[model samples]
Target chain A: MEDTGTRSFVERLLQLDRRWIFLGIALAVVVPFLVPGFKMRSGVVSPRTQSIYDTINGLPAQSVVMFAFDYGPASIPEMQPMAVALCKHAMSRDLRVIGVAIHPQGPLLGGQALREAAEEYGKQDGVDYVNLGYKPGGAAAIKGIGTNIYKVFPTDLSGRNSATLAVMQGVRTYDNIDFIVALSSTPAPFSWIAFAHEAYGAKMGVGVTAVMATDFYPYLQTDQIVGLINGLKGAAEYEDLIRHPSYGMLGMSAQSVAHLWIILTVIIGNIAFFMWRARTRG
Target chain B: MEPGEAVATGMYYLSGPVIGTGVAVLLTLAIYSFLYADNPVYKFAEHLFVGVSAAYGVAITYHMAVLPLIIDPLFRPQNTPSGQPQYWVIIPALLGLMMFSRFFRRYDWMSRWPIAFMMGIGAGLAIPATVQTSLLPHLYSTMQPLAPMAEGRLDLLTGIDNLLLLVGVVCVLIYFYFSLEHKGVFGVASRVGIWFLMIAFGAGFGNTVMARISLLIGRVQFLRFDVPEIFFPPSP
Candidate 1:
């Protein structure tokens, strides 16, 4: 009778409704935000993220750095913070910033980042920064910039002629640009490396979603890319480096709790499965 | 407050961004309703998302690609920096137009020409670049001094890491080598390769979980912070 009771309990655990897990996740995410001043421990900045920070930090004032916004709305949570942080860091250092997009929706997001950062720094448009906007070709567009940026992007996002913009004064090709960072949720980094880095000898870095982070390890190892920003953790790390806590920092507590919840569920599910299996075998 | 001031405040609440945020919050909730169960609200949200995405994509393509690349350059010459028509732009435009041939069965073969041209250009660019940037560099990096002496002292940690990397790479390659039957030492190596592959997959899965959680946190943030901000505008 005890054995029967044990088996039934194990069976119930095994057949637990998945909605319970969903509710648990929701609570784990929400409860963190409710606690005033809740925050996950700031992580050690990884070598890859530090490399990017160092590169940007080491650049001289007014040196042009192109940020390729190669992601869309779906990646806003992960990619946008990095974009904003990079923009802030670059503009704060008084580095001349240029924004371009390969992804269709990239310009809007890039423009937003540039505008926000520029506004905070009191930087003027057409002088301190310019958004070249989206171009059709992926790798070809990058390659075009290597030869002549004006031909690829004749006008800024606001329709100001490229030649007339003060930001474009000395910037004619990739040779003039100090660094190129591709903030991507796709494999657009590979295209940048191929056309911009390999072909034109341009220095490049990448900011990618966590899912695509592993794929860039080989490139990072080989020095094809200077650094990598991996997903939200990377964004948080950047925020920490810049001393500007924003969305990335805010999300960390919830992220940590959610992860713990997932781990708990996995353990529970596994234990229930094993118990059921042992009873069946007996 | 006066009646007139209250009326003005009501108008202020119905501003563009406030209304947009309200709509966004509704759509977000509709989508999140799927976590409870598959329902009409979720389906409606999904359909709306798809439709909006498609529409946005079309508008952006027209604005960014078609107008600037084709129409402005070829027809609206004054818009060009040189203030002269780029007649050469028609060639690429024609090639782009050729892609539409795939819609008709009889003309599908014509689509092949543009496809072939693209393939040829892509291959021509990618082949050399890949070999130089990816293949050669990876090979060179892998073939490092396994046991390096730093200032006349052996670097054990560096040596071990290099040795493990070399072993892992070789074993993984052997696992993919189906030319010979797996047995004895080869089978053992193949098993090791499987372990490595499993570890890689596990790491990827973990990262994927983190990415999904971050997305969820983003939505939650919108609900908690953004929605309230929409209702109560912060004083400048």
Candidate 2:
């Protein structure tokens, strides 16, 4: 009778409503914030993230570093933190930052990051940094920038002449750029690697969403990109390196709890499946 | 100053950010309602999001690409550095306009010209660069010396990693080779390849989960902290 009861319980678990899982996820995410003095240590920085920090840190003051914003609002949570962190790091290092975008929504998102970081650092517009903004073609536009930046971005995002901007002063092409970092939720990094890195030998790195991170390992290993920042954990690692904890660090506790919830569910679901299968076979 | 009056004054000062935050919170909650069950609220939010995104795309394209690249260059020649019309802009603009021909059945074939031009140019530019950046470098990295020497002596760990990588790559490649039958030694290699592929897939899936959880955490943070903060500013 006990054996039959145990079997039925497992079967019931197997048939558990998915809404329960959703509620569990919500609780897991919420409880961390509610708990008093709860904080998860932003763990040891990964070498891949370290490589990005080191690359930026190693650059000389006033070196031109271009950031390609190639993501949309859907990716704001994952992509924006990296952009802000990177922008802050670059500005702190006194590097001349130039922003560009291949995605339509990238300009606005990139501009927001730049504005936030600039405000923190008290950096001036046009003189310290400039937003070249979005262009239509992806790989082709990147190639055009490699040839003549003035021709591709004749005017800045605000309709100011590119030639008149202080940041654009000697930045004619990839030859002038010290480094390029493409923050993307799309395959824009590959386009940069092809046109900017391979074609013109522009040194580059990439910050990508976690799902796309695995796809770029081969490139990272081959030194096609100087470094790779993989999603939010990567953003946290970067925040730690820069000694300024923001959204990335704040989200770690909730992220950990939610992940634990997922793992627990997966284990239970698997156990229930196996038990049900054995019962059916018997 | 009275406390209620101070609160009212603060709200007036922060009206813009507060109203924006309220709308964001509503939309977020409406979207999350789908978790309970697909309802009108969720459907309304979803449709609103889609419509807004489409409109934003069109507006951005015009401001970023059309106005500056085509209209300004051709019409307002004074805006150009040379202070003369860029005739070259007309060619690309005409090609871009040809894209709209697909909307009309009779002239739909004209769309092929721009498509072919783009494909031809893209392939011509990408093939050589892809080979140099992706294919060759990957091959070179894979062809590492198994017994790598660091300083003077052989690095055992490095050698082991290189060997494992080599074996994994070879096995995976063999698994994709379908000309021969899966029997004898080939079958064993293919099975090993399957294990490697599964491990890769597992890692990819884990990363994907992490990405989704991070997004959820972001929204949750906004609701938990940002919303309240917008209404009640912390004293300096």
Candidate 3:
């Protein structure tokens, strides 16, 4: 009777309400922030993040780097920190940053990141930076820009003539730009690889959501892209490298706690599954 | 408090930070409510997300692409050809309009012309790029020297990693080769391929988990740190 009772309990445990897991995750996220003097230390930096940092570091001052924002608001959490860190790093190095987005919502997000970073560095707009705004046509637009920037974006996001912007001077195509850093959550990275890098021989790098990061490993190995930054972890690593750990560090602690909770649930659930299976077999 | 004072208090609460926090917190809670069970709040939030996103996309497309590229060139005065209308935009404008023909029963066939034109251009662009960027490079990288040189000698660790990668690639390719039957050596190779596939999938899953957890952490940070600092400051 005791054996049967224990087996029933194990089975019930396996089938417990998913809300329990949700609540656990909630507490895991909340408790860390509530705690005093708790900070998540940055782990060993990946080769990928190091490579991206090196590429940006190597650029000459005032050299243009096109920051392509190809993500939407839904992906802001993962990509925003990356955007901020990259822009911050670039501005600190005195690199001329040109912001553009293939996705509609990307420009709004990208513009915000640019403004914040430029403000920190006391950089002037139309001189040190420019937001070319959102362009349409996806891969075709990338191709057009790579060929002739004027043909693609006749005006900046603010409806100012592209020809008049001081940043636009001597920068008409990918040929003039030093490097391209594409921040994307979709197949936009592949499109950049296919169109911009291949056609124009533009030196490219990518910052992608963690899930999409692995897919770009091949491109990195082939030297098609100079470097890669993978999701929030990658952003945190960059932030740490630049000595400006902000939201990325905070997010990392919560992420680590939440991950531990999930891993624990998985282990417990697996044990219950195995116990139930053994009982059924007997 | 006086009625006038109450009105001022209400106006202060309606400022950017307060309204932003209130809406964001409410929406976040509504979304999170899905963990318990499907509810009206969750559904409302879901619909709002989709509807707002769609409208935003349309508005951006019109503002960024359609108006500037097509409408303005056709209607507005421009430097092209002595301030004359570009007129070339008419061709593309017609093609784009034809896309709407699919909505009508009889005019459905007209949509096919534009569809074919687009497909042809897409295929033309994609084929060479696929070969150069993805397919050819993939093959080239996969066929790397297993014995990597390190300080004028073959490095054991690098060689081992390379050998394993080579084996994984070859086996996986063999597994997909339908012409061969899974017997003896073929079966063993295919089994090894399955193991490699499982490892790759496991790595992918780990990455996906990291991404989802990162997004969750972002929201948690906002609610915990950002919202309070912005909207509900502690009294000095």
Candidate 4:
């Protein structure tokens, strides 16, 4: 007779309905979003993240900061929160914000954020901050910003010339830039540390996709980036640090349930694996 | 609205057709279901994602890298609204063009100039910064309070984490070092190093899953609200 049991095992393995798993994962994540615990469980916070916060927190009012939005729509929720937080913190501290977008969609993405955050902070546009929309060339854009921020983009996203804006007066290049923060999904402007910090001298900070975080930690430890927030987890921690219960925290409460669910799945899967192996050996 | 705005508005309408939203939501959920096991829906979504990402990559490069920087600047020099190039733009443009030659088998050798420039700058960046950013500060930071600081320098947490990190760094470095064959104490260290690497990889795996899941959640939100009136009725 044909080995029916082995065939069945193979068939199950081949034809398993992934929708059930998706349903579980959906429940795991969505449930957490619905009922946010805001549970601040203690975990390792890399020194890189700590320094970034400290660097910004220490800045004085009217300190012109070049904030680069190098990420796109794919990175909206994860990176935007930190970007918004940085803007809020910047405006709250009275820092002059000069926003530049390297991605075409970035200015619009970051502009909407800057607008909402500004409304909350009671900040004016040209007087407090200005958006110098997207530029072409990856490192060349960095090169331009390093030399002259105003030269790169003459007009703000609102079509106001940089020369006319009072906020743009003192700001020009890496020298004028007190702090540079960027949020990237795919190590956007990955060369900032190499080109911006190393070639020139600009104190840098970043919010990168978590996968890229480890690659950067060596740099973070070396102090290339004054602060390094890796992925959503880092964003959540920074949210915690600022005491702002924005999307990061709410997302975290949602994320934790999913994380727990994943852990349980792994545990169960492992047990099943062992049981199968034992049965086979028997 | 201007002619350009009118055209863009038309394109926007064309991009996401009425049925597009519903299909996108179901496919997204289906794609996410792959965590359970391999299924047709998940496969369909995965294929779609792959296709979409590849198209996005091509479009981004064309729109962002080639057109605005290269084609418009050179071919339509007179129409260049941003003023004079003064030869500086030409070098970067030529170098970027050289990078495309790398895709051609017969002409691949021509690509080296740009590749060399990239490598030279990359090498220039790695040495000093790598030492300053990766090595020294990491060594320094690892000296933290596993608990609290002692009077002089209490590195309980910092010391241990740093040590783990350092060992991982050294061992992983050795694995790729390849100067000599793996054997004896060195082999043992490399083996231990691999375990650390695996753990790091595991953490990486978890992070990736989390990111993809987040992206999925976003599409679902778009669908549930945007599509043919699902459970959620448009956020107020």
Give the winner by lDDT.
1
**Any idea how many clashes model 4 has?**
8
User: What docking grade applies to model 2?
Assistant: medium
What residue pairs clash in candidate 2, if any at all?
none
Ranking by lDDT: 1, 2, 3, 4
Judged by DockQ relative to the true structure, which candidate is superior, 1 or 3?
A: 1
B51-170: candidate 1 lDDT, tens digit per residue = 999999999999999998889888998887888888998898899899999999999998999999999999988899889889999999999789889999999999998998998999
Candidate order by decreasing DockQ: 1, 2, 3, 4
Give model 4's docking category: incorrect
Measured on C-alpha atoms, candidate 3 has an lDDT of: 0.87
| Candidate 4 interface RMSD (Å) | 4.2
Off by over 4 Å in 2: B1-16, B234-236
Model 1: how many Å of interface RMSD? Answer: 1.0
lDDT of 3 by residue, B1-236 (tens): 55346445665466676787889999998998998999999999999999988999889888877887787788874622235577888998899899999999999999998999999888988899999899988888878777889899989898888799799998998899999798899999999999999998888888898898887887888888888875755443
Worst 10 residues of 3 chain A by lDDT: A37-46
> Which regions of candidate 3 fall more than 4 Å away from where they truly are?
B1-9, B78-84, B233-236
Model 1 pairs whose backbones collide: none
Clashing pairs in 4: A52-A227, A218-B134, A222-B133, B142-B158, B144-B158, B145-B157, B146-B156, B146-B157
* Rank by TM-score (best first): 1, 2, 3, 4
Give candidate 4 regions above 4 Å deviation.
Answer: A1-19, A33-50, A154-160, A241-244, A278-282, B1-166, B177-181, B220-236
